[model samples]
Target: MAALSRLLLAALLAFAAPAFGLAQQPAAPEAEAPQVLRFRFKPPADGRLAYRIVQRDRVVFAGTEKARAWSHVVEVRVGGARPPDMLEATITLSDVRLDEGPADDPYYLVAKTLEGRALPAVLHDSGAPVETAWAALKREVAAGLARHTDPETARGLAAALDRLDPEGVTVLYRPLYLASVGHLLGFNTDGSVRSYDDYTGPGAVMVDGRWAASAAGRREGEPVVLELGWRIGMDPDAAARALGPVLQGLAEAAARPEDRAAVKARLAAELADGMEMSERADAEYDYALALIARFTHRHVLATAGYGKEAVLEMERIAP
Candidate 1:
């Protein structure tokens, strides 16, 4: 009787095993490699977003040096119906907390215009910025140039801007450009640097008169990280020769002839020694790769045994 009861219990256990998932089952297949950083972005717009900015720099001369750093926030708004593939936004940078800042910095003084100012920032995946959007930013910059200087000086400044490389401007100086377009930059998850043009073949870099650059990618925690940088290329002699007329013009507008000569002489002395330039733009992004968590674009140029480094960073504030 006991053996029969035991047999009955064994049969009952065997019958319930499949229902409870206790039976042997085939192993699940392993997950395939992720298609990392293939840009399938859905631009987030029609709302408000805040981004924090941080920048730092130091100039080293022989044994003496100068360094500075600052951080602030900018609020962006893009209303109306959101586009499925693009974002058009206006950024307002005014009345925000600056967690870090430096005193007696001329560049900072000019950049202060950033606060309380509204600027156009657009994000699209055209591989290059649309002409209209580029013109919009250039217009804002042109307006600022006029507001800050005499007509002659403004014209000189505009000339200087005209001489500037669009690629360099889009990369480092224009915060809005980086904020809106950095994500659209091409990246490779295998840590190989390639040209922005996908058809350019592997190991090739995007080249222009001012820069030869590309970005590499890797996984970092929950975000995709990209390491991008520039190889500084400028002939000091060429630069000095080009800068003399602009400086003289500006000085003519605002200072005495002697002052103008003195300024030109000073700048010539400064750029006399050719510089070696290097830069880095490292960025990290979340799941959708929508926004960079932290993006730092830094440059260090060495001349006459001295080095000057400038750094700029942008971070998105958590909602």
Candidate 2:
């Protein structure tokens, strides 16, 4: 009887084993792959977004020099709407302060001139001169200079402006362009990767949450930061027709003998230390058009071969 009882117990235990094993197994719903975060622009509702942009520059004239920085508080707003993919936006400079440079520094002067100015919304892709915006900024700079009571200070500021002429306005206004359109250059309507070559190329790098020109070596902290407070959609072609006046102005400028001579001199200087002028018939108009084309078609952000960086940081200040 005992042997029969043992056999029955063993058979019952064997039958329960498979059931216990099944119960112990954990069910996994599914394994999902990690998603990649490709860069793209998502516009906010139509309104103003405020941001603080900071830039640091370290120049080594002899030995390692001290780092310098400047900042601007800007308000950005959508000026027009282009659903889904494109938009137009304006960035206005509300305030500016130089944190790291001497008052006489050219960089500091440039920062001072940028305060209380509005960078009008314009097409990033449009190969057109931003004459209207440039004119407005020139006036703004002049007004700022007029406010300075000190003769030396005023003269220094004026000299700085002269040195940065034509290019100075472009440099100052470029931050607005980059902040507004840098990310858009990375995408297309079909959701394909757009070529960086078409815009800024490999001269820049995305840092923190913003784009920066690539640095030679890692700095202890970010040297530049562009905190984007807002972005929204706008019409892509609205600023295209605005180029008419600028083009007309260019035509007029090209007709001037002095302007033509200046272009030739500049071109000659760029070719070599002592490039010979061609004795052939002077193509002044052609030279002017070439210069305009070169300037107008340039990337919104300046390209650096190496040893430079741009750090962009985006933040939302409004719903």
Candidate 3:
């Protein structure tokens, strides 16, 4: 039986080797997968971008001026016997407006070229150096756009794109700000607010004022990072009107230790209503109240700064 078990194990190992393509392993182990390139396009500028990935002096992959808002994926396998060296490259951007671009321009191109296209030319040229793809891809893109009127040429361009691997190319762009009073952005490991400004690779952009983050690429299980910041230019009256009383109540409760439980209960009830708080303290109070209700094992509502009369009002639910 022991000998039979050893033979079974040997057979399993052999089967697993083929499953992992280990039987076809070259003299050297497979090279590590190339890291995806990252790019950031913040507000106030737009321009086209292009890129080419060359391996063994052949354009393994090439793309031009895709929109930034639409994430893209491109992949290319430099098919050959010898190991291929992957080269990554990008283009520089100048201002171009979305309104000015050709009507047929793809969504990804619009996103990539946003900084140059969206903002004023003067402001666009002024702010900062926008990163983009390589010159060769840009040149090809320009040539391709010129052929848009020619059906055959346009078809060839589309076919070329189809051949390119659609695994790595991605784009992210900011959308309009909401009218909400407050939002929670994400943070980096070092505690700085994460922003498109700080992005060096494809990362999530919390377009809806920091309460959410969406990854730029479709790669499975990629980590999405967030950082919170207040949006300027929102109406102060709106925020104040929304937050004032809630903030005051939280302040009062925080100051009264004996009333903490009642305060917590109130916060929990507010949270249960699916209300969005304009102040961080109120949000924290809601979170604290939730934790107490979940884990405290005893009701603390009597001490929630509410007198006996108020306690009676809550007693039905407090237990």
Top candidate, metric TM-score: 1
Our tally of clashes for model 1 stands at: 2
lDDT tens string, model 3, 1-319?
1221222222111211222111111222364432322222212112222211110100000111111111221111111121132222222222322333233333234234332332211111111212223222433453554333345434544444433322213221111111011122222322222223321221111112323211111213422322122212112233224433443343342335686566556544333322221111000101211111110000001111111100000000121
* Deviation in Å, model 1, residue 35 alpha carbon: 11
Question: What TM-score, over all chains together, does every model reach?
Answer: 0.54, 0.42, 0.18
Tens-digit lDDT track of model 1 for 56-120: 76644324445567656767665443366555666665543323433423234334434577665
lDDT of 2 at 273: 20
| Model 2 spans > 4 angstroms off | 1-39, 82-88, 104-111, 117-119, 123-132, 146-170, 179-182, 185-316
TM-score result, candidate 1: 0.54
lDDT of 1 at 286: 51
* Per-residue lDDT over 15-79 for candidate 2, one digit per residue giving the tens place of the 0 to 100 score: 11222111122223363322222223333455555555565543221122334566666566655
Better of 2 and 3 by lDDT: 2
lDDT of each: 0.44, 0.34, 0.23
lDDT of 3 at 243: 39
